[model samples]
Target: MADPIDPSGLGRLLSETMSALGQFGGGPQDDVVPPEGVGEAADGMVRAAVAPPGRVTALALDPRVMRMASESLAEEITRAVNGALADLQEKAAGAVPGQVDLGGLGDQLRRIQEDAGRQLTKFTDSLIEAQDRLARQGGK
Candidate 1:
C-alpha cells in the first residue's frame, strides 16, 4: 500500500507558495535605512557608532584610554570599530521589509519543492509502468 499523503503538509506548502507570490507582487523597491549600531570596548572606554551605510558616525574615547601607547590605542579602536560594524551588518540583514529569512522559510521551501518534485516524478513513472502493463495484457 502507498503511504498516505498528509493534507497538512500540502496546506503548508500552499501557504508558503502564496506568501512568496504575494511578497514578489511588487517590483524592486528602495533600500530601507537601517538603525545605527554601537559597540564598546576596553570596559566601555572606547565606544563607536556605526551609522547607516556602514560609516563610523561617532567615536567616544574616554580620557582613561588616552594614557595607553599609540599602538595599544589603535588596537582598542580597531576592536571597538569592528564590533560596531559587525552589529550593523546583522541589523541591516534583519531590517529589510518582506525579506524571507533563509534560515527558516528558505529551508522549508527548498525541502517542499524537492519533495514535490520527487513525488511528481514517482507518480509519472508509475503511470507509465501501468500503461505499459495494460498494453502488454491487452496484447496477450
Candidate 2:
C-alpha cells in the first residue's frame, strides 16, 4: 500500500513554507520602501509557491502542533502577499488585486501545493544545466 498521508499534511506544508518564507524575508528591520519591498515580497511569495509539500511530510515536528502552526503560516503568507500587493498598488497606481480577491490566488496556490510532484522538473533542469556547463569545460 502507498504510505499514508498525514491528515494534517497541508497544515504542515503551510508551517514549513512559512518558516522558509520567514528566512527568505528576514524581518521588519529588513523592510525597505516601494519597489525594493515589492521585489522582496514577491520573492517570498514565489518561494512559498515553489516549495514542495512532500518535504513537509519529512519534517520532525509534532503533528498536532505543526497543524496549528501551518494554519497560522498559511494566513501569514496570504496576508504578506496581499499586503505587498496593496503597497505596490498604492505606489504604482496599478491593478494589484485586492485582499478580497485572494480567493482566486489561493485557489492557484492550492493547486500548486497539491501538484508538488512537478518540483522534480526544476531539479532536472538544474542538473541538465550543470551537465551542460561541465561539458563546456571539456570535463574540467
Candidate 3:
C-alpha cells in the first residue's frame, strides 16, 4: 500500500518557515474570541460600537444629544468614532492567540538584509582587488 501524505505535518513545516521569516503565526484562534470596542461621548449621550478591523458596527445617540447644536453633535460623533476605532485596534491586537509581534521583527529583518548587503559588497570588493592584483602581476 502507498504511504498516505501527512498534510498536517507539511502544514506545520510551512507555518514554521513563514513564522521564522517574520511572516505570521500558525494555528486557528477562533477560541480567543475578539472583544468589541465601545466609545462614548457626552456622558454616553453618543456611543459607537466598533468591531474588528476598526469597523463601526453601530452607533447610538441619546435623544438629549439632539438638543445640542449641530456642530457640537458632529464633534461628539467624531470623537466617539475615533475613540471606538482606537479601542478596536487595541482589542484586535490582544485578541489573537500565539500572535507574533511584528514590530521588532520588521526592524530586525531590515538590519539583517542590510548586513547581508554590506557583506556581499565587501566580498565583491575583495574579489575585484584580487583580480586587479593578479592582472598586474600577469602583465609584469
Candidate 4:
C-alpha cells in the first residue's frame, strides 16, 4: 500500500493560509475585546466581519487529519461566512436606492431575503457539522 499521507504538512499549510487571510482582511484582532456595556465607544470602523450566508461553503471543509488543519478548516469556514455576508451587505446597500417603488421593491426584497435565509440556514447547518467533526477529531 502507498505510504500514509502526511497530515502534519496539510495542517501547517492550512494554518498559515488562514493566518494570512485573516491578516489580509482586517489585520489581527485584539486578543481581548472590550465589554459591550461600557457605554460610548469609538467611531465606526470596518473590520473583517464574517457574514452568515456563507456558513456552509465556509464550513464544508475536510482536510487530512492534523490538529492544525482542523483548526484552519474551522477558521476558513468562519472567514468565508464573514466574506459572504460583507458581499450581501454591499448588494443590499446598492439595491436600496434602485428599489424605489415600494410594492415592486417589497416583492424583490422579499425574494432576496428568502433566498438569503435559505442559504444562511444551509451554511449554518454545515458549519455545525464541521464543528462536530472537529470535536470528534479532538476526542480521538
Candidate 5:
C-alpha cells in the first residue's frame, strides 16, 4: 500500500530547502568584509596585512629594516608577504563550507525529492481509487 500524503512533511522539506539555499545567498554578511590578516617577519621589522582575494592591504617596514642590504630587505619583504597570504588563506578556508557540507546538502535535496515523489504517487493513487469507486456507483 502507498504511504499517505503528509502536508506537514512537505512543508518542512520546503522550509529546509530554502534554509539551505539561503546560506549561499546575499544577506547581512554580504556587506561586511572579512577582517584583514596581518603577518610579520624579521623580528616584527616587516609587516603585511592581506585582505580577501589575496590582496595586500598594507605593508609596513621598521626604520631599522631600511638600513639592511637591498637583497636582505627584499627577502624580509617576501617572507612577510608569504606569511600574510598564508594567514589569509587560513581564514578564508575557515569561512567557507567544505566538501562534506556540500555533499550533505546534496543528500538532503535528494531525500526531499524522493519524499515529494512518494507523496505525489500516493495522492494520485488515492484520487484514482476514488474515481473508480464513483464510476462503479454510477453504473449500478
Candidate 6:
C-alpha cells in the first residue's frame, strides 16, 4: 500500500524545493564578494583589472610602455584586457555551482503533481462511497 500523504510532509517538500530553486537565482552567490581579476602583458608593462559581470575596473600602463609604437602598444593593451577578462571568468566560475540539475527538479515536481492527483482521486472515491451508503440507509 502507498504511504498516506501527510500535509506537513508535503509542506516540507515544497519548502525544500523552493530553497533549491532559490540557489539558482540569488542564494549563496549573493554573499560572495568576488575578488578582482588582474592581468599583465608585455612583461607587466600593461596591466588590467576586471570585476564581476565583465567590467574592466582599471587599466594601467607602465611609463616604459609609452616608448613602444602605437600598434604594439594597442596589442599589449588588448592582451592585458583579454587576460583580465579570462581571469575574472575563471574565478567567477569557481565561486559558483558548476551545474544545476533542472531536469531533476522537474522530475521532482512531476512526482509531486502525481501524488496530489492520486490523493484527490482517493478523496473523491471516499466521498462518493459515503454518499451512497447514506442514501441506502435513508431509503430503509
Q: Which has the greatest TM-score?
A: 6
Off by over 4 Å in 1: 1-33, 98-140
Assess the local accuracy of residue 55 in candidate 5 as a C-alpha lDDT between 0 and 100. Answer: 89
Per-residue CA lDDT of candidate 6, range 1-140, in tens?
Answer: 33454556556656766775775555756667887788899999999999978889999999999999999999999999999998888887786766778887677777767766776666667677779889999999
Candidate 4 vs 5: which has more lDDT: 5
Give a tens-digit lDDT track for model 1, residues 34-83: 58888888899999999878899989999999999999999999999999
Ranking by TM-score: 6, 5, 3, 1, 4, 2
Off by over 4 Å in 4: 1-100
Q: Tell me the deviation in Å of residue 26 in model 4.
A: 33
TM-score per candidate, chains pooled: 0.48, 0.22, 0.50, 0.28, 0.58, 0.60
Query: If both were scored by TM-score, which would come out higher, candidate 1 or candidate 4?
Result: 1
Q: What lDDT does each candidate get?
A: 0.77, 0.45, 0.75, 0.45, 0.82, 0.80
Lowest summed lDDT across 10 adjacent residues in model 2 is found at: 50-59
Candidate 2 C-alpha lDDT tens digits along 14-70: 765665444444434455433322311222432211111112111122334334556
Residue 88 error, candidate 2, Å:
0.8
lDDT of 4 at 49: 31
Error of 4 at 20 (Å): 35
**Which lDDT tens digits does candidate 3 get at residues 21-137?**
745544446665667888999999999988876678999999999999999999999999999888888887776557576876676666666655555566567677779889999
Candidate 3 lDDT at 22 equals 40
Q: 60, model 2: CA deviation in Å?
A: 21
- Where's the lowest-lDDT run of ten residues in candidate 5? 20-29
Q: Which stretches of candidate 5 lie over 4 Å from their true place?
A: 1-14, 22-35, 98-104, 114-140
Model 6 spans with C-alpha error above 4 angstroms = 1-10, 23-28, 114-140
What would the TM-score be for candidate 6 when compared with the true structure? 0.60
Give the per-residue lDDT digits (tens) of candidate 4, residues 109-135.
466556555555665676777798899
